[model samples]
Target: MSTERPRIVIAGGGLAGLSLSLALKQALGDAIEVAMCDPALKRDPHGDKRAYAIAASARRMLETLHIWDAVADKAQPIRDMVITDSRLQDPVRPTFLTFAGEVEEGEPFAHMVAGGDLTAALVESCRNAGVALMPTSVETFSAHPGGIDVVTNGGGITLRACLLVAADGARSRLREQAGISWISWPYRQSAIVATILHARDHEGRAVEHFLPAGPFAILPLKPETLPDGRIQHRSSIVWTERSEEVPHLLDAHTEDLLDELERRFGLQLGELSFETKPQAFPLSFGVARRFTAERLALLGDAAHVIHPIAGQGLNLGLHDAAALAEIVVEALRLGRDPGSADVLDDYERARRADITAMGLMTDGLNRLFSNDALPVRLVRDLGLGLVDRMPGLKKFFIREAAGLAGGTAPRLLRGEAL
Candidate 1:
């Protein structure tokens, strides 16, 4: 290893990559160096229109890194959540399960945050923490005994680091180059995401309607105030539909789109109008055969991509960031190489089971609800109803969803320093 302070290079600057950089710098201070590269960092921070349900543990990690305060005002806490199963044409959709979102005295299980806002906050935090935010993409890298040599796409800037992390997202070129096998299968569904301006407040309530195609999620967002002094009650919609029908829906007339949205949205929020153009994302489930190899480690979508049925994808990535940061920080503080096979193996071991469980859970949920089979519906509905009646089980599920159930949670996730 280099005689100077060990450096870690992250090959993406998305949520996971940025968070990992911030976490390492915050914990290790001047003892270690962190650099992150992603072309998206050079683009407008507000370009992303998606919103995410950040679980309680992820919020704690952000708080520990001093990032939560920057975005807190814009985050809408999920005070409650309701789940229903019904067909699109059904006049009545009965709620099969309901949850009061708090997992602790006053801490809600999750908060809905706009992707752009959170990303901007994280970027700022990384800058303030002294992380080298390179506005370039990693073109290639080669791991040797001492460290990994990373070459950037722009100007062939070569960076030598103690470790190279691939956070470049689901279609990671680095993962492919490293010969990491990816097991994946596409879903028959795609999610239509958009912002909805409703006439009434959401009251921090989130609703998930499981239709024949897939689950339609209405997640609350902080109300927006216009310059005209009007407060616009807003919510984000994740409308999952069959993949074959996405193009027609996207190209549909405004009136036609509104009509289609209303069919699933109902009239509970009074009037509804588009706050932004709807966008569709094809859904898929995938996991890397291995999370680590040589001095290279995968994070976020580079490691796995799960169904969005539970809104846990981003949170899972955050978990990866926290866990990896903790492991690397601890190893470095002990005078061990942070990128060594032993250190990387510790990270992989710490994260694999959690990732596997979440993948299977989301996949099973999507499969069980995204169909109209009578037998399956009856069994699943009965299960939901039974769980709803059991307060203990309900609380357990809420804690698990909040990422607070496991005792082995990383220090950062528990709102602690390394």
Candidate 2:
């Protein structure tokens, strides 16, 4: 290996940013310098509550950072998934077109994780792995031919690396500072997320019901991971709706919200009640005009943000991190600048096909399901049914959805029993 190590500067302390910090340190050991900046730390969010379903692929990434063990108790592995296209009148009988395979041997594709727990785990991992975490947000950033200069309220820190990663999230100020334009489309809807206590066991299975308005994802909460290290049962729900309808729904009381949820959710699990008041986030699809510019590179939401219908938001970003870290590690070994133009091009090439395909698929799904177009619904339901029947094809869907379809797969994601 080359005797030289690049200094890495990461913006945003969220999943993607914090993750890069640890992954770099783990791979480089004491060779490279890694620094990350974020607003407040952890889940000290002054914003609304949100969560994501961590695919088995993503869990492996966290394991690589040593965060999975810390937060695994909070995750409920989705042994199976039941998908349906339900109607208001025929709510009891949701057409079960496609279901995931559970007895395939190894494990399910993904698991359920709360937003708070995930952030906390990442923060702890970053600290444990010795990745310097700057408890400051970026004031701005400027990329030059060699590296970039980043300014934060705490002070100015300049990192000269092979590249600068903008994992700062969808509204990434870093991308804008670098003059990267984004392609955006309004989704005309909002997702309402909250915790729920179901009368029956989820059996570690997730349910997605495609309604006229949008898709409803009910993820099972395996157990709670307490600050004191105790575990308990819990689960979270994500309900999507029209923009204008969210306010009215949020304005509803707990009972009303539960009633509304039950109407759309049906009696799959039975007697579901809200454990937390619903929170709403406007949904949209956005992708940067370019994944890289000069010495600057983008990952995660900063690179692209799509409808959450598939719940790959974080998984996509984490995979981007994994891909990038691998590329940089290999480049440095060859005595190449990690941020060099050629190196950056290779990173984009490895990820672009998969990223663009997923974005388009999600965006198309969202648009196709948002309305009650008879023809569209008919076609979609038929498609789901076909997949259900095609066991060979279902396995492919599971593996792809689970993020297990990469040849240069990251270490943790290989499910190597981390």
Candidate 3:
């Protein structure tokens, strides 16, 4: 057996980068070396209050990587989801559609995981797997015929790798340096994210209330243990608002904002109190002109980003990592260069359709429901109602949401070894 191993370096150690590192390690074993760079990750190894929706398929990938077990105790399964369309002050926001999030007897289609917990688990897993975790950003890099040389801090520290994966984010400096043009447009909206302690149990139910402003999501989260060993019900709230209104909402008094949240959140979950100061994220849609360039490949937000209406942004990025890892591993087995044009082309071809379809779906849904036009409202509500009444169609959607319907699915998603 050859002792030489190809080196793969991932920039921006967020979910996508961490995932790719872990997947590559699993698939290639000692055949390849993986490294990740992102100072922000090391700065706050403990994540924030935001929560992520990991679909069933993504969960399986986590399981295969031996990550699910580390964080499963902190994960909250989403048993059911209900959708409604109404105004902020509407006396009633009747549910127009609902989904049963189960793929089998006891398996839910998705889970709500605290970003901090997930990140901590992934970081620990990466360390145990012997993957190099660099606490610095990729300042610049040059791609040559055989490999790419990356400089961490203005030529201070340099490293060469056969492949350079850009998981930097939507505004990726690596992508820009690679001359990869991406189409990006702001959505004129923003999301306020925060965690709340509620007075009652959520029963593992999630809710999305669509108002003229945007979608207000109440995502169930696992209970928290206090210093006194008391359990408190908690959930993540994603409140979307027009960009112009975000400043006022962010600066508003806590009491005033709580009142607004209550109006939309309903009294079902009982009293709500913010567990942390709310943070705002501007909305936008972006897709790179190409997924690969020379010795480089884009993963996660570096390649694409979409509205939060569907809560699939992270899930899509994880899928990218899975597919890319599979392709790279197969190429290695065949004695082919992992960063070759052919390998990257195959990865791009496999992922383009899925990415484009999701972008369009989320964009359309945001446009359809973020308005008060009576005709548009009526038509969409009717559509939701119709879908709700159709068990077959609902099942298809459930499967899709579970990440079960798609091409280019990796072995990990199929519950198999890499």
Leading candidate by lDDT = 1
The 10-residue segment with the lowest total lDDT in model 2:
42-51
Highest-scoring model, TM-score: 1
Off by over 4 Å in 3: 1-3, 227-230
Instruction: Kindly provide the TM-score of model 2 when superposed on the true structure, using C-alpha atoms.
Output: 0.91
Predicted candidate 3 versus true structure: per-residue lDDT over 114-171, tens digit per residue: 8888888888888888899988889998888888898886336888888999999999
* Model 2: per-residue Cα lDDT over 1-418, one tens digit each: 2355567778787777777777888887777888787766633632334657888777777776678887777567887888877655663655665556342476767877667777776777677777777777767666677566666767665544556788888998878988989999888889988888766677787788787778888787775456998644456777888899998988888788778888876675667776677788899999887898777789899999989999888888888888888888888767888878898898888778878889999998888777687887788878888888998888888887888764667655664321
Give the TM-score of each candidate.
0.99, 0.91, 0.97
Off by more than 4 A, model 2: 1-5, 42-49, 101-104, 157-162, 223-233, 406-412, 415-418
Candidate 3 TM-score versus the reference: 0.97
Looking at model 1, which ten-residue stretch has the lowest summed lDDT?
Answer: 1-10
Error of 1 at 90 (Å): 1.2
Clashing pairs in 2: 56-110, 162-339, 221-234, 221-235, 224-232
Cα lDDT of model 1 by residue, 1-418, tens digit: 5579889999998898999999999888999889999988889877788999999999999999898998999999999999999889988999999999899989999999999999899898899999998999999999999899999999999999989999999999999999999999999899999999999989999999999999999999999899999989999999999999999998999999999999999899989999899999999999999999989999999999999999999999999999999999889878899999999999999999999999999999999898799898999999999999999999999999999996689998898977
Q: What is the lDDT of residue 341 in candidate 1?
A: 97
